[model samples]
Target chain A: MNKQTYFKKFKNIKYPISRRGLLISFMFYSFFHFSRKLYANGEIGGPFRDRFQSFRQTFRVEPNPEEAKRIINNIIKGRDKRNNLILLNAPDIAENGNVVPINFSVNCSMNGNDYPKVVHILVLDNPFPEIAKFFFSNQSGSADLAIRIRMRQSSEVVAIAEMADGTVGEDRFFVDVTIGACS
Target chain B: MARKNYRRRLKAPLTAKKGEVITIKTMAEHTMEPGVRRDPKTGLIYPRFIIDSVIVRYNGKQIFRSRWYSGVSENPYMSFKIKVEESGLLEIEWIDDYKQSTFKRSVINVLDNNGNEIFPIRLSEPSQSENLQ
Candidate 1:
């Protein structure tokens, strides 16, 4: 139909309009312009700000492996025992980077003296690479863990475990991206 | 105040035999709200909403745990393997940064070496647990 005819027919429709409809239409149109401005200004800053703040207050360093190691090492400085380590990597080809399944098992002796005290996983290249930090006691028998993570791109994944006697261990994995995993 | 919504689902078998290493798949409905998006009406930034941690337990004992970040998607899905040994219930609990928590439970049936259902146990109700703090 021609544009003029379409407009005429639309206006002549025998449906009664309520004030709510007019108010909604006006709000919708106003929102369209408002959203355009927001997009142009790029004012988006989600939960990442809180994450950044937390990292800054806790570690005072970037969320990279080297930085993480330094921070963790400082926490265990002056200790005498070694820590067991396991490196976990995403699959060679991830279908989605946003929610990639990553698993790591630390072969630690479950004995009272050698049990793992904590497990920390870090992604070196993500916007916020610190994926998870798990603290365990002797009761948590095994040091094996699995989790899903969001990846911005191909990056290195690292896992670090601390033992009861101050021993520290480490693991690393490389992830290749076939698809973006984060929105 | 904005209303928050979250949900989770399991994709693995609900029953397994003792010592059987089976994969458990789970996904949750979440906004994973980064708090970065601007309100089209007010032009103000939204608050952040994301899952921070999850724990899985069998018969009152923790078997799996994890901590997540904002990089995760709006609705997050996770898969992991657990070796069952006793006839006990399976439970999963998820918590967000806002101090909100949700729990899900499923019955686990322990089987014999011949794959016979020998023992069936129901997991605890996560919502009713006082350990959520």
Candidate 2:
């Protein structure tokens, strides 16, 4: 039971190496490795690769142009009643994009069908376009609001007012942001 | 876990004439994380934590409401207008993304043309007056 005898107990045991099994295992490993490389390089997985990843990882999500358009259209719908109902006031030049002061007022009298049901604020270049929405009731004497918001870049800020009588009014304002804010 | 204390500020007129429009301003102290900014040291994205909605109620009746997203700036400030007919309590509630809510309350005094303050509930009645007599 000495250490030297215990270490030499199985020193003479021998095993045969099979070249066929080694070749097969190597082939499987290489197949998987190469396939993964191909996938990582976008040589395979065409549809999925284009939409998701191509190895360049970015923390900030890119703003989708089509999605912004879709949201604008969804708010305006087909009935674009271009009128002087909604008056949006935003600074033409924002020194700090982190806090952009914006205010909007609806000319409606807040009576029966003239009052605004909802006023939606959208920034076209932000990753998430829809910013805020205001719901007003008859008790809300005036449909006016002032708020502070964040902007990723210089873009058109849109305010769409949907009235109770099935009418919609849209207003757009362009803001020049000196320094973009990350959202 | 919501460990930060959100400070709320509400400003409204103490008194108003009947059918007069009054302006109300509200502010809430919050970080308003947009869920996209990464930590510079660890490179980990900060989760979105923002005030989701704001509700303004007059005498327990909602008069104005708002829904907000991550685009709102930190320490959000909002101001709106409401018409008052009778004196009532005004409550403004700010609801956060984690379902945490904070509110502020203020009482408004509505007055009539004769400058008599309109009480929410009638104080004097014919039976009461007769009993007093």
Candidate 3:
């Protein structure tokens, strides 16, 4: 549709009424539907993919093993691996970087005999990724915790849970961040 | 007045099993202004004002402590687990770079899973005295 017709058809729209605006709007409006269609057809790389590619280029943080090791050293200190009792829950693709809901839970009985001593969350690519450290005592009664954190862009999220007996448990996963919360 | 709007909401079970593990969730409302980010209009860097440390203590024993940087997102939300040793107090302290401090306290009670109070076994109990006699 022509820009004039498009604008007139959807009048009262105060902004983005030019030809470029109309095209951009049309693309933006159909991005989700088109992406869905591509997935349904078992195909990849649609119009939205191109836009995301550019976004990735601009806000990408390449995963570095060395950097992750550095972070582990800072947080976990000496012990890095122990048990697979920790869960790091995050979306495969973050629709909004501004408000990413991330939850990290340590699977250990809050019983006096066993419990998590501390839990730490780190984003591999954040400019300063040491998000937070959580300490737990017996009175806490459970080792479950949830927290929302920000990602600079697309990077790996690491969760490490250290038990009172010095047992270490951890989970790591990557998240594709679209819009950065740091901005 | 501005600081008043910045708030913290903590959710935890009022009671848990004597040794049960329960989850605690918290959400804090704050701008988390990164000192590095510049105001678009004024072109001046907004001073860094982020929660610098969060310490949680249970029954007067330190359980959790975190040191933070400005990279933390705004309105931080965190969850973690702990064992319930006994009925006691859960105290949370938050400090920011601006030297502002906030404290939040919640009372926690411990009982059996069936909701019965878990009484400690005392050596001087009446039943124990009768058995001794």
Best by DockQ: 2
Q: Taking the tens digit of each residue's C-alpha lDDT, what string does model 2 give over A3-42? A: 9998887676554756688889999999988887776554
The segments of candidate 3 whose C-alpha lies over 4 angstroms from its true place after superposition are: A1-68, A73-80, A109-115, A163-168, B15-17, B109-133
What is model 3's C-alpha RMSD? 20.9
Residues B82-103 of candidate 3 have per-residue lDDT tens digits of 6665687888888867667887
Per-residue lDDT over A1-183 for candidate 3, one digit per residue giving the tens place of the 0 to 100 score: 788988786676656468898998899879977776675343664211211211112232334556556557655657758766898888999987767777766676666758877777877776555666676666665556666677768888888887888778879999998777653
Candidate 1 residue lDDT tens string, B49-73: 6788889887888866777766666
Please give the distance, in angstroms, between residue B109's alpha carbon in candidate 3 and its true position after superposition: 4.1
Worst 10 residues of 3 chain B by lDDT: B115-124
Which of candidates 1 and 3 is the stronger one according to lDDT?
A: 3
In terms of lDDT, the poorest run of 10 residues in model 2 chain B is: B1-10
Question: Count of backbone clashes for each model?
Answer: 21, 0, 18
Q: Which runs in model 2 stand beyond 4 Å of their true positions?
A: A1-59, B1-5, B123-133
TM-score of 2: 0.78
Model 1 error, position A40 (Å): 33
**Residue A60 CA displacement from its true place in model 2, Å:** 2.6
Estimate, for each residue in B30-125, the C-alpha lDDT of model 2 and write its tens digit.
888877788889988886777889999999999888988878999899988999999999999899877888889999999899989998777597
